[model samples]
Target: MLIRVLFAVLVVVSLVLGYVGLAEYLATSAQYAHRPLDLLYYDLQLFVINSAPVSNGGPYPWPLEVSRFLTPAVTAYAVVEAARLLFASEIARLRARRRARHIIVCGDSLAARTLASHLDAEHRVVRVESARSPAPLIAAGLPRAARLYACADETAANIATVLAASQVERKVHAPLEIHAHVSDPELGDALRDRGWREGLEVDFFSLDGVAAKQVIAAEQPDGERLVVIGLSAFGRALLLELARRRTEPVEVTVVDPDGEAVVAELAARHPFFAVACHVSVVPVYQPEPGVHLVFVCHDDEERALRDGLNAAATVDATRGTVIVRMAELAGVGEMMVQHGQEDRLRFVGVLDMASVYLSERITDSLARAVHRRYVRAQRALGQDVRSNPSLVDWDDLPDTLRDANRASAGDIERKLELVGCRLVPSLEAAAFTFEPEEVERLAVAEHERWVAERRADGWRYGSRRDNERKLHPDLRPWSDLGEAERQKDRNVVLALPEILADAGYRIVRR
Candidate 1:
């Protein structure tokens, strides 16, 4: 931008200098009689190296001589810049194709653009205008890309790009991590559960889900009473995320016109809804007393803001917060602050939150480390691919399992808090350890956390372990677990320091 500005200034200055010099030359010299407009026109011609003002000149003015060289140089620079602008994308695409381990973002959608913008400068990002065909993906360097994000506006387009990328992955005999943006929660769930091509690891995510995760992380909304207004996709995602994070059942009231249908849909999709939350549905928007957090998730930004404001007015300022879902924060957020409701009224932008969380989740070092540790542990136990399906590499692991690992990684901070320790950034190698009693306590906590997670995922205790039926023998109480099962939890607890260290963090007793 600064270069363009300088170039523009140079062009204007050159043109002005040329006009003044030509005017002065014509005024003093007896060569030609021309008007000011004609002088200006002739001065403009100098830029293109066109007709010179002087036919038979004895001497030229200093300004005229300067303009004579400056105009043409500026013209040449303009031409070169134009050419560069025209071919920059193509050049970048070609270079990206030759580069190995680069990230390819295949889409021009908001999510894709946002993700591309948020990506770290360390990783080379190649963006395709659209993902309607495999040609663009290949052109964007899909074959050599370490990761591909198919974030087209249409879910179908993202799926098509994923399939194309998978075929390329198979042909090249190289691994690729593909993340597809599926807006519909049910479709995202179904696609994830159905699984994808073997050699290529595929994951599906929704804007709402990402936004919900961001909101929970930022707000830490763990109140006893929660109210969700407007049963939009974001609302559903928020409920699910809340359920996943909460260790105990929380009272939740969902206010929407189609409350019954929404409740039924949630129950059908997630059996763990009943286990993690005590929920009630109400058609009318009522300000429930003692509500800790209220999420206004209307699809319409204006409606969401209006409801959020109303909730903010009634809810206790000290105890409650109203979070409104917004497409962007510019107009609505300022209005809230102006109205002095900034403290209690918060807004979450879908694209902003989604882009941030999506990038972090996809390239999460801690989550990758967690998966690697799990794989190592499984291998140490002599478990092969046939014996354990999750005994594969991080890229080859299914999305569900990957999410579980990510969830476990996400809980490390909370686990650290339980042991009176906190994670702090560290550049050097971390060699921290927990006390023996602390490790045992954390192990118990980890086991209980795992059991809750399993139950919330619709798993049930059974005599035999069955993945197909969502049954596991170790789903019983921590006391009922054999020493082997208990040891696994203890191992994870002990490995906390190493895991945190790998992710550039070290545990420090608080």
Candidate 2:
């Protein structure tokens, strides 16, 4: 009789527990169901407990004595029912996202992964075809393109997958962006011929005749660093010249405020940029020559840059120190000439807005032209070169800065905001703690490389003789090349080392 009673109790407990779970499951999908159980230690109660004690026991707790028969079947039914209700929509949601918008990437490289992760998740993506993956760089940036040209991967097979999966004809985006070789030189082009407008973006994956110039150094060496600060919008072009002309570097730092990332990235995996780049806050104080370049943003920024540099730089006239100021920047280039002559330092003014505006690669070619002109102009000038003022007295900097600020102390940030000079803060570092030597050397090496390569190629110098005359120390050695040259190269990438001469920065080269 005791055994029979225990068995009956067990049956009653199962019926009650199963009923409760079903009620909770029914009201909402099991995905949405949650609540507290009756007991403290037993709050989790996966199974039911018999609350009735010895006082007056009920034979069975369930409404029907036959509920025991259905207990075993209830467990399986409730579990599956809850899971289906909970996850059915979730599965459908993912599939829908994949419908027309999803992009299936195929490379297993680190760069590919990083680019994918940083992109917006809503931009559906999948790595469906990566086995012995063909190059996929061309297709990677399409989803980010500003204009039209996106792949038309309807419900059929994915354009990325088909091209990568050996079913090349099925790839809707005609030109498959293969990070590696596409194997067939004609394949990328053939797809376009066959009505698919797919083509290489040229920043990356354009193996043949890609205008391949934006290299890092001569011999096109790898891993050299470049930090360029252009005073105008032309800085963007300067970056392209460096990358295409030099060899790949470990890393290149481009100080540009535009959206040049696509160009920077595809050409070299190691390229970095200092966004919103501007000239130094102070004038190139005691502008010297060598690896460092101190440039003012405009004629207005000139005094600010000059005052800042003069205040910060050291000066020594006996050593022939000179700080060159570029007045051609705006209409105020004569500021360098006036300061140089008054200070009795080596000061020479150039009619050279063109040289200042040349792209790094293009300017690299201007050396022969520069050398020839300076040589010719020097002989014709009856005045002495020694009379040039190369160094700006360090003691004079405080007053100079204060005075320049008084005249026009505005920075480049406010002016170019419309042309998207928002990246100025990159140059306007809150705490500029870098040792000048390292950054200077890096910039000079890059400039020399850029200049040297152009010299080798033999570029055209428009007015070599005319520039030589104005570059001379007789006050205006290269006056003819002014402002016209300003629109040529953007700004001087090579800062004057302590080699400031009266010819703007002659003393700095020492």
Candidate 3:
């Protein structure tokens, strides 16, 4: 708007100057340029061609040249400036359309929006709706996107976005990274399975899980009595994480109106709650001295803040800390850091949870990638990387292999998720054993997977184990394999649950 106004003023001033200059030249030289049509024609000719239609017999030649040049220059400048201002939005869109290797964030949910905010500083971000169809993706500049985040509120919508993005052929040479927001364990497993089977780079994460881990890590409530308000999804996840982290038995008193029902249901789903930690359910919060940490995680933002503040007020400021889950941290900043108050009050917003979740996602991806590289390098040297007992530290690997390993780790994790298996040493205790016949099928499935991976790497069917530096070079039919080889295969299949657990997944069933 300002550009248009400035140019308009310039155009009017130029025309007036041109008219006045031509009139003065005619008056001083007795050229009779005072006739209105003649004067207008002469001004127009000067502005267009920097030359008057008739010779300006003015006394000063320089003044005539200045008038001619100034009129045309100002008029051209006004036209160009007006066009640029009028089409500014369209020009920006065009530039974005041509850009590649940018991040595309799907959905308008709080988590998605928050995640985008963190990434916006380092990457170009485009937001799109979570539609089943691919039109929204294309409209959101998916073809140019290097990373796509599927963070819709609904699990189904997130899944759809990931699937749609996976099928998109990015303009860049590298595969597009698809990060999906997953709150449910089951949904995460399913998406991971799809990624493994198809070799797509899809990641699943939950802000609730991120929040739980972060709170537990910060509080470090080891063997300390704690009070947790609300038994919502976020609350249960936090309780479960706390129980997992605590080495010593700690009493956790859960408070809410329907605490009993929530705790009972959650305990059934998660066995650690019953075995590792002692927990009690109550209808209302009863603040006590010596409380190590108070987590007010009610779904209602205002109530949670109020409850946390009230609990902090009752507790001795030096011993206990109150943490409140709020939608917006700015609204109640004063309560978080009360002036002249000893009780340390902390506020955790959804955006904070989202930020933690994204950071974890990157960390997990990189770790898995590095591990994958380590295993692959071992395999190339004829070592059974999968069966190797030692766990390799990702940080120990060299920089050259880090990127390749990260990519391969994504593939390996996807495959691991697809088989509904993982390598947990405690998996046998966690999962029910299958029938002998089913166990045989599991071994055969692993054998088939091994064969497929070998074939993909250009290994042919062979049985010459002497010359070839192959760990399992005897590529004969599975039926012909010895009992020892078969047993090892079966052991690998049985370890699936533990492996899944290690990858932040809970294997509920064998």
Candidate 4:
């Protein structure tokens, strides 16, 4: 707005100066008398083409030359500035579209801002302020977006954003990945369930889950003695994940004012925690020697920071790593970076963790789905696949194969959900039922997914004799498939409903 006003002022000043300066030059020096209207007309012409000869047909007066030079310069400046102002937004939209993969983040919340900051360093990010509607996403170029993050302050706003983005994705068939932020893990799980039912690409992320993963992943093998000084959502999540990931039996002392009741509730919620680790709850912090990790995760940022600092002071600097969770982490992070670097203190922020939680929703889920299919396919081949499909290192998969598998998994999931056999969590939790025909339709979808995965692994169509017994050469549609081949696809689809249940999911009607 300021730029437009400045350009307008420049243009007006130029016009006035051109007319007055040239008119005075004509009257005094050239002795060429003319009407004020005539002088104004001449000045307008001069402004359009400053180098054009003066109509006086005499040596150009000094003032006329000055007017000539100043007029066109300002005129050109105004014209260019006007054009830029008119098309600036369009040009920016075009630039964003040209980026092969870009993310659209909607909302002005801390999570949205943090995500944009993290992503902007590498990927093109278009941020929109509208949290209540999806219109901002469409206006921000949703058709070209590879991912959309809806991280609003309110859960309802985030849900609304997902609905809006889903509508855009359905209309364009653009395969846009949408991520919605939810603080509660159960709510996030329910949203994922709803996503499968809606046949839309949406996932929910929790910052507490992200922080739990981060802290657990940082632990060394020998480090088992840990002190967790809160029973907040994040603290409980950390303890559960720690127990789940621990190979050997471990002990975790939980210091919470809520006492044994909170610990008992958490253990019951996650049965694995009870079987894998010993959790002792105490009323207050007790500094124990050889404590490997100390986590001060409180809802209040100041209290968490103070508790973390106190815990850090008690622990041996060379032996323990202190992890602090703060709603706002800027001051603590900088303070630790400056003074507490030697103490091995780690800081986690509720809002900034959204970047980690939301960034991998699409890719990570795709990878997991591919791994599940791989295990199912291998079992069908009569190979002795392990009880735990994720036992094998997914990171060791070839880049080409992983990419292909993820793409194929995404396509398969979409198609399966479009039909009635959408995935859900357990039989009792199923929101809808899959009909016999819908289950049969999934066989055809699975067959295509198989073919695509095989092709991705470098298999190609060819005659058996020419190909010398190459795999997946006789790829055919479900109708053309013989009973044996059809059975293979059907076997995978038939196993899905129960397999999903065992894997903490089920297949429900779309």
Kindly report which residue stretches of model 2 are placed more than 4 angstroms away from their true locations once superposed.
Answer: 1-59, 62-98, 108-110, 133-166, 171-290, 293-510
Positional deviation of residue 487's Cα in model 4 after best superposition, in angstroms: 15
Residue 60 in model 4: lDDT: 63
Per lDDT, the best of the predicted structures is 1
Give the CA lDDT, 0 to 100, for residue 101 in model 1.
60
TM-score-best of 1 and 4: 1
Per-residue lDDT over 335-405 for candidate 3, one digit per residue giving the tens place of the 0 to 100 score: 54766443477777755666656745555543453464446556766776366533344433444345444
Best by TM-score: 1
Clashing pairs in 1: none
TM per candidate: 0.67, 0.23, 0.60, 0.61
Looking at candidate 3, what is the lDDT of residue 368? 58
TM-score of candidate 3 relative to the true fold: 0.60
Lowest summed lDDT window (length 10), candidate 2: 501-510
Model 4 C-alpha lDDT per residue in residues 1-510, reported as the tens digit of each score = 897787678667767766766666667644445578767777788767832337545466566666677778877887797899899988876775554346788888877888898887767789887746556666677765667888877778888888777666433322456778777754776667653523255667677776776667666435558888998878877877777677777888889878589778767877887887788888899887788788888878888878877887788767887788875664666587588463567787766665865665434554555565666667766666355333343433545556765665556557666674465433132433456786678778777777766666567765452433445545756777678877776666665544443333455554
Report every candidate's CA lDDT.
Answer: 0.79, 0.31, 0.65, 0.68
lDDT of 1 by residue, 428-450 (tens): 45578789899888999898888
The 10 consecutive residues of candidate 4 with the worst lDDT sum are 424-433
Tens-digit lDDT track for model 2 on 446-494? 3344344334444334334233332221122233335544222222222
Cα lDDT of candidate 4 equals: 0.68
What's the distance in Å from true for residue 457, model 2?
A: 31
The local lDDT score (0 to 100) that residue 357 gets in candidate 1 is 67
